[model samples]
Target: MLTMAIVILLLLMCATIPVAVTLIILAFVLGYFYSDFPFYLAAGEVLWTNSENYTLIAIPLFVLIGEILVRCGSARKAYSIMDAWLSWLPGGLIHANIGASVLFSATSGSSVATAATISTIALPEGRRLGYSEGIFSGAVAAGGTLGILIPPSISLIIYGIFTETSIPKLFAAGVIPGLLLAALFCFVTIVCSVIKPSISGQRAKYNWKTRIVGLFSLMPLFLLFFVVVGSIYAGLATPTEAAAIGVLAAVGIAAAGRSFSIAMFTDAVLGSLRTTAMIMLIVLASYFLNFVLSTLGINEQIEALFSGMNLSALETLLLVFCIYIVLGMFIETLSLMVITLPVLAPIVFAQGFDKVWFGVVVIILIEMALITPPVGLNLYVVQGVRKRGSIMDIVVGALPYVLAMFVLLYILVIYPQVALYLPNKV
Candidate 1:
């Protein structure tokens, strides 16, 4: 049944149908063929319950913050400030792409938004400064993937909802790994620039006073990240409530930038509404499909099958890792998560892995998907911003960072404490 579902899913995805609609169709097809019970009757209640989950409220609030930042020109200003501070690094201005992306991802909660924001600001600068297209473009795309791994992550929220895990704990678990992953990307750029020397452009010098002034420009973002993530960490607010606070803080940032207006606010609302609706549809449809899988006992079957194999925990984990790498190559990240969690979540837990740890693990896999080829959204977003070069340059550039992700994954596997420490300690 599991194999059949994958085959049918791939077939439907090959059609022009929307992924949400395809998931719905897959649920119906599987129910009719494999289930003894009437599954459709249960879908409405299950989907509605999942739709009404309060944790979902965080997604739009997070998205709205990103939209406001985008429209208010904060991303552009933030990128310039980051460039000023990081320009003297080994990789020159390219390090600013990663730095600016880390700041935006901490608040934006959407990988695509972070990628697009940095791409818009940094691509022209790269062109003007003679930076290597492959490495520069790759840095932007790879850095943007952090949006999903960092706190206030939309993907983490969805993962929490699906697994019935603590959203706050999941958020906490992501912080250390997320920051470390950001550092790893910088380390890669540094190594590559040191090895090749031509991968980066000329380094520019900044006066101490100039760098200090630019730091002031970045204070709003830091303070905003602090308020939002800090509140959640301090137990002063739930993720949803903290997201509400983030929206207000983002608007203030926009207003301070002199970029906020009635018209700008309206645009941000509409943009958020559109993104939210699409995400909710995918969420609801995947839940309905999960209900069908449960009714058919497919998850149980997969669990029994895995147990039957007599695989050790580490072996099972390596197999699952390989599965995600293959799936990430083709599926959209959100659809991939929602569709697979029902089947894999039980198998993972039965193997004695913590759901919270698995949640972070899955998010890192999703981050990998974002920069990968064929369907890597960040790759396309970065390439689109460049508009003149072959997309292959960006793809080639991103390979090293892909290796960086693999390195981080290896560390987490060997020492789960790296991911579990923050959540466990807090």
Candidate 2:
């Protein structure tokens, strides 16, 4: 049954059906044929429940904040500020790409938004500065993946909802790993630039006074990140509450930049609504599919099959990693998470792995998916911004960062503390 489902899903997707619609079709087919109850009716209830989730409310709020920042031009301003301080690094503006992504990702929980925002600003600048297309575009694509791994990540919030873990802890856990990934990205750029110095262009020259002045521009973002993530850590707000605070802070930042306007605010609201609707559709469809699978005892079959293998925990983890890396290539990130987490999370727990640790691991894999070929959304987004480059440029550019992410995965596997330490302390 599982094999059949996979085949049909692939066929449906190949036929150019929308992902949400494909998921819904699969759920209905499984339920109608395999289940004892009317799964469609149950689906209505599941959809209603998921829609009412206060925690899920964080999705639109964070998306709205990101949209507002993008529209109000604060994102570009923020990027320019980051460039001033970081362009002096070995990789020159590439360092600023990662640095800006890090700051923007803290506010924008969506990787697509982060990539688009940075690409819009960074690509033209790279062209003007004589930077290598491959590395520059790659930096934008790879750096944007941090949007999902960093604090206030929509992915972490959804992971928390699915696994019944503490969202705050997940946020706490992601900080160290996210920053590590950023540093690794930077390190990759530095190493490559040192070997082929021309690939990065000259280290950008900025006066110390000018750089110090630009440092002040970072304060708004820092304060906003602190208010949002800090509120969660200080136990003053739930993740949802913190997200609401983040929205307000983002609006204020946009206003401070003198970019906020009524028209921009309207566009931001519409953008948030559209994005949220698309995400909720997938979430609801996946939830319904999960219910159907559970009702038909497929989940139990999966559990028993894994148990029968009697594989060691480490071996099981390796197998899970393989599954994600393969699945991630074809599916959108959020849809992939919603579809797999229900089945995979339980198995990992059964193997005695920490869900919090595994959550970070899964996010890393998802980050890779965003840059992987064929369907890596970040690649397309970045390429679209370039408006002229071959898509291969984005793919080839992001490849090193992909490798860096793999190394990070291995490190996490060896020492789960990279993900668990902050959560444990908090």
Candidate 3:
């Protein structure tokens, strides 16, 4: 029965069915066939109650902040500041693409939005500067994944809600690993450029004075990041409240940049609404699927299957890693996470793994998923903005960063403290 369900899911997703509809159909199918009770009746209640969750309110607010940044020219400004500081690196503007992404991720807290915002700003610049378009777009896609790994991440918030974990602690834990993964990406770029300097764009060295002045331009972003992420870390605001505050700060930044108006704000709100609606729909459907599976005793089946393998905890984790990598290749990163967590979270806890640590590891996997081929959302995002190249260029470019993620994953597995230290301090 489980195998049949998996086949149906893979087929539906492969056939380009919308994920929310796919999940809903799969849930109802499972409930109708396998359960003695009329289980589909509970879906409406499940969705409604979950939709009303206060923690979930943060999604729209974080999304609004990203939309405002994208619309108001703040994202472009942030990119330029990164260019001024980092364009002289061996990989030239490639570093800036990543630096800007890291900065943007702090505020956006979303992978797709970060990719869209940064790629829109950086693609033309990278193209004109003579950087290899493939690598440039690839770098943007990879960097955008940081949006979910960094604090104030929408993915982390969703994971917290699904697993009943501490959202603040999850945020705190992601800080060090997220920054480290970003630094590792830089190192990969530098190494790639050094190996084949021809792949790099024309390098430009800004004067110390201009660079110094550009530092002030970054102050606004810093303050925005601090306001959004800082408020949470300081225990002064909940994630939802911090997201609300960030929305205001984003509007202020837009207004200061002379891009604010009723029309612009309305557009941002609409974009936020569209993105949030899609996310909420999938989330609601996933919650129902989770409920259906629970009522069907899928957890017991999963435990039985793992026990039949007689694998140690480490071996079980390795298998889970393989599952994510394979599933990631086919499923959209966000949908894959939302759907699979229902099954995988129980496995993680059963292995005596710390929930917060596992959350960070899961995010790293999601980051890998964001760059992989076929369904990598960021690849399409970057390619969409570039609009002139085969997305395979992005796939090729992002391939190297996958190695960096593997390194980060290996480090966390070997040294769990890397993810745990900040959370513990918190």
Candidate 4:
């Protein structure tokens, strides 16, 4: 039954059907063939429970905040401030791309929104400054993945809720690893620039006065970051409430900037609704499918298979990591997490791994899913922003960062403290 469901889903995906529809179809098929429950009743229950999730409210709110920042020109302002500080590096604007993305990730929760926001602001600058499409687009796609790895992350919240871990601690744990990955991306950009100077543009120099002046424009981002993440850590707000705070803060910033016209506001809200609806549909369907699979004893089958392997804890984890990379290639990030977390997380915990550390590691894999092929949302985002570049350009550009992610993954494996240190100290 599982094989049939996967095969049907794959064929539908190959036929270019929408992912949400594919998932729904598979859920219905599985419900009919694999369970005694009526298909309609099962589907309705799944949809209802998925949409009624209070925690899931964070998804749309965070997305709306990101959209407002983009529409109100706050995204550009933040990028400009980052550029002022980082544009003198070897990769010039590419380093700024990474830096700006890391900053935006601190506030934003959606990787696609982060990629879209940064690409809208930074893609033009790369072209205006004659930077290569490969590196420029690649940097935005790769760096934007930080949205899920940094604090105030929607992904981590979902993971925490699913696994019954502390959301604040998960958010805190992501900080050091997120920053480390950002730094690694910058380092990779510099190394690439030095090796192939043709991919880089002339470095920009800014006086201290100009740089300091630019910093003022970044206050909105910093404020939003504090309101969202600070509220979580201070125990003042749940992750959902923090998301609401972020949305209100974004609106205020847009109004303050005089960029909040009715049209822009409407567009931001609509974009948020559309994205949220799409994400919710897939999430709901995945839950229904997972329910059916669990009832059919698929989870037990998987656990039995793993138990029979008799592998060491580290070996079991490495195997799970390998599975995530393969699955990530074809699965959407949120859906992938929702489907696998219930089944895989317990296995990891039973192996004596820290849930917080595994959360960070899973986030890095999710980040990879954003830029990987066949279904890489970030690749399509960067591609949509550019009129002339091939999708291959973005994929090739993200390859270096993919390797960087592998190295980061290995480092985390050896030294779980990288993820655990900040949360533990705090």
Candidate 5:
């Protein structure tokens, strides 16, 4: 039954059917053949349980916040500030792309939003300055992946809720690794620039006075980050509540800047609704499929398979990491997390790995998913913003960062403390 379902899903995906509908079809087909449960009942139950999740409310709020930031010019201000700070690097605005993404990731919780915001602000600059579209788009696509790895991340909140882990601890755990990945991205950009100076644009330096002026435009984002993330860690609000706080704060910032038009608000709300609906549909379908798979004992089968391998815990972990990377290439990020976390987290925890560390590692892999071919959300987003670039260019450009991610993945494996240390101390 599982084999048939897999075959059907592959065919549907290859045919370019929507992922949510594909998942629902697979779930119903599997449930009908493998179990005596009524397909409609199972489907309805799955949909209700997944949609009724209180934690899932954060998804829209975060999406709304991101839209508001983009509308109100916070995202552009962030890019300007990062450009002032990092444009002197070998890759010029490429570094700013990554830098702005890292900073925006601190405030925004959605990868698509991060990519859209950064690409909207930075892509024109790249073109105007005669930078390579491949590198520029790739940087935005890759940098946007940081949205899931930083604090106040909607993905982490969802992960924690699904896995029954501490969201605050998971948020804390991501901070160090998120910052490290940002630094590594900058380093790689510099190295690539030095090796191929032609691909890198002309380096620009700003006077201190100009840099300081740029800093003022960045304060809104900084304050948003502090309020959202700080509220969570300080025990002042739940993750969902903090997201609400973020939404309100974002609106205030927009109003203060006089960018808060009714049309902007309508667009923000409608955009949030569209994105949230899309995400929730896949999420609901994946949850149902996961439920069916769990009922059919797939998790047990997986656990037994791992146990039968007689591998050490670390070896088992590396194997699972590889699985995520492979699955990431085909699956949407939220669906990927929903389908795997329930099955994988238990095995990981049984091996005595810190839940928080595993969360960061999973998020890094999720970031890779955002840039991979065939189904990378960020790749599509960056491509959508480009009037002419092939999707392959974005994928090719993201290759360097994908390699960097693998290196960082190994580092996290060897030094789990990179993710766990801050959470532990705090």
Candidate 6:
């Protein structure tokens, strides 16, 4: 049954079917061949359950905040400010691309949004300064993946819901690792730039006074992050409520910048609704697929396989990491998470690992997915913004950061505290 299901899934995906539709098709096929239960009825329950999730409300709200910020010119301001301060680094403007991503990720929970927003603002700078296209584009794509790893992340919210873990703890757990990953990306960029001087771009020296002035431009983003993630941590708001607060704060920031208008709000709402519909479709389909898999004893089969191997916990984890990397290269990140967590979460939990820690690890892998080839969403996003380069440029550029992710993955495995410390402290 597993083999058949996978075969059908591959065929569907290869035929260019959408992820959500492919998932639903697989669920129906699996139920028809393998189960006696009514699949249609089961699907209805899944749809209803997904529709009723309050935590899921965070997805659209956060998406709207990102849209508003992007349309209102905050993204450009962030890039300029980060470029002023971080351009002094070895990679020049590339560091700013990453720094801006980290700051924006705190507000925008969508990787595609982060990549798109930063690409628009930073790609022009890269071109004007004669930066290496591959590295510059790769940096934007890779850095944007931080959107999933940082706090107030929609991906983490979905993961928490799937695993029944604490959303706040997952948010807390992501903080240190997210920042660490961002630093590693910048380090990789610096090393590459230092090794190949042409890739470094023009490093414009800035005075402290100028840099300090640039820092002021970052204040709105910082405030939004504090209000959203801070409110959640301080027990002042649920994730949903925090999302609402973020939307309000984002609107105020837009208004203060004189970018708020009926047309802008209309565009933001339309974009948010479109993204939300796509996400909710996948969410609903995944829930149905997960329900079917559970009913068909896939989890029991997996447990038996693990037991038969009698592998150590660390070995099992390493195996799971390998699986994620391979799958990450092909599947959309959110769809990958939704489809796998149902099967893998129980196994990881059974091995005495923390669910929240596992979530951090998985998110890092998802970040890797965003830059990986074939189906890496961020790579395409960055490429779209470039409007001239081949997709492979972004893919090749992201390779180094992908390596950074692998290193981080093993480090997380060896020392789980990297992800758990903050959550534990809080």
Provide the TM-score for each candidate, comma-separated. Answer: 0.97, 0.97, 0.98, 0.95, 0.96, 0.98
lDDT per residue for candidate 6 within 1-426, as digits (tens), equals: 878988998899889899999999999999999988888986777789778988998899999999999999988888887888889888899999999999889999989999999998889988999999999999999999999999889999999999999999999999988998998998898899888878877877788998898788778889999999899989999999999999999999999999999999999999999999999999989998888888998768877887899899988988888889899888899999998898888888899999999999999988888888898999988888899969998889999999989888878888999999989877
lDDT scores in order? 0.89, 0.89, 0.90, 0.86, 0.86, 0.90
Tens-digit per-residue lDDT, 342-421, candidate 1: 77877888889999999999999989999887889899999888888798899899999999999999999889989899
lDDT of 2 at 321: 94
In TM-score terms, candidate 2 sits at 0.97
Clashes of each: 0, 0, 0, 0, 0, 0
Instruction: Please provide, for model 3 over 1-426, each residue's C-alpha lDDT reduced to its tens digit, 9 standing for 90 to 100.
Output: 678689889999988999999998888888788888887678778888888899999999999998898898878888888888888778999998888888888888899999988898888888888989888888999999999999889999999998999999999999999999989999999999989888887877788888889889778888998998789889899999999999999999989989899999999999999999999999998888888878888767877888899888999999999999999989998899998898988887898999999999999998888999778999998888888868888899999889999999999999999999999998
Per-prediction CA RMSD (Å)? 1.4, 1.2, 1.1, 1.7, 1.6, 1.1
Candidate 1, residue 193: CA error in Å?
Answer: 1.2
CA lDDT for candidate 1: 0.89
Angstrom error at residue 233, model 5: 1.1
Candidate 5 lDDT over 1-426, as tens digits, reads 545766887798888898889888887777778889786765776688778878888889988998888888888888888898889878999999998998888877888889988998888889888888887789899999999998878789878877888888998998989889888888888888888788776556789998989888788888999898889888899888999999999999999999999999999999999988887887788788788888888778888888999989989898998899898999888878977898889998999988888899999998889999888999999888887858898888889999889889989988888888888876
- Model 3 ranges off by over 4 Å: none
Q: How far out, in Å, is residue 309 in model 1?
A: 1.2
Candidate 2 residue pairs in backbone clash: none
Query: Between which residue pairs do clashes occur in model 3?
Result: none
lDDT of 6 at 302: 76
Error of model 4, residue 131, in angstroms: 1.6
Please list the residue runs of candidate 2 whose C-alpha ends up more than 4 Å from where it truly belongs after superposition: none
